[model samples]
Target: MCAFIKVSIATFAVCNRISKVLGFDDYKFIATPVVLLMLSFSIFVTQNTMESHFSISNIWQYYSFPFEAIIPFVVFIVAEIRRKRTKVL
Candidate 1:
């Protein structure tokens, strides 16, 4: 859990920086879909390589929701807070 939070924040930070440097103010929106697609593709590939079955169980599907949904939501919230703070200064 700790590792997941750390990696998620770090990934968001790096992608945020890159987007800024590339002049994209709405980078979070773009990054979210791309990251999700990559994650889904990787999971599919990994399951194919290691498991006899390619399908993910419903419980495991539920487990993935937080990582996919929560992390980006947190990142967006944090980014919004920071943006507001900087604008106020």
Candidate 2:
């Protein structure tokens, strides 16, 4: 769990920087919510532990069906937008 948090933080930082440089501000924007949601879910599942913290009950009880999927879908959309925009440059 600690490792995952660390990695997420590191990756966010790197992505934040890279996105800014690439002028894909939308990447960072879209990433924030997705990353936050995933981290929150992960933390909940980890139950404040390193492993097996999240249970089926918790996932069903607390989070909704679309919670996990939203981030990636938004990311893909943003990526496609960025791709399209880049093609014109």
Candidate 3:
């Protein structure tokens, strides 16, 4: 699917960027295998991964709440404060 392809490309780009950040330029070739391995691992972790992924459970909801909600809100508030401070100057 298009979304999967986009995610895979993003993952590969992230891996390349990370390698550069870590001063591992010569190891760029390793990124492709690592990303593919991780993606495959995620897909085959359980028997019903794709099926169960759609049906959110309470535990996942609780675990993801701060990340999916709080962090973005905090970032937005911080950006707003900075914007207002800049406007006042």
Candidate 4:
């Protein structure tokens, strides 16, 4: 449950970055479906690779620290800092 929420938030953050990078902020109808499809693909691949008995422990050992959760959180912090710096200047 917590993992799901973390992943959803990260996905939204990633989607926002993608939209900004692609200049699609005005066309969320287009960017949204693309982002969702990519998210689904990522989840599908992760699930299949992690579900296997032999690979389960390996993945858990390497990824147990919630690196996915950290990435978008770090990105958010950096973005906020940049925004604040720009506002101050």
Predicted model with the maximum lDDT: 3
Error of 1 at 34 (Å): 24
Q: Per-residue lDDT for 1-89 in model 2, tens only? A: 99889987876776777688878845556577666877797677566543454555565556555666877789899999999999999
lDDT of each: 0.77, 0.72, 0.79, 0.74
Superior by TM-score: candidate 1 or candidate 3: 3
Clashing pairs for predicted structure model 1, backbone only: none
Q: Which lDDT tens digits does candidate 4 get at residues 1-89?
A: 99989877776677777778888756455557866797688787667643765666676667755666778789899999999999999
TM-scores of the models, in the order given = 0.39, 0.33, 0.60, 0.44
Report the alpha-carbon TM-score of model 3 versus the true structure. Answer: 0.60
lDDT at 20 for candidate 2?
81
- Candidate 2 weakest lDDT stretch, 10 residues: 48-57
Look at candidate 4 and tell me the lDDT of residue 50.
35
Cα error of candidate 2 at position 13, Å? 16
List where candidate 4 sits over 4 angstroms from the true fold.
Answer: 30-32, 39-53, 59-89
Residue 8 of model 3: what lDDT? 70
Error of 2 at 32 (Å): 30
Q: What is the lDDT of residue 53 in candidate 4?
A: 59
- The order by descending lDDT is 3, 1, 4, 2
In order of listing, the candidates' clash counts read: 0, 3, 0, 0
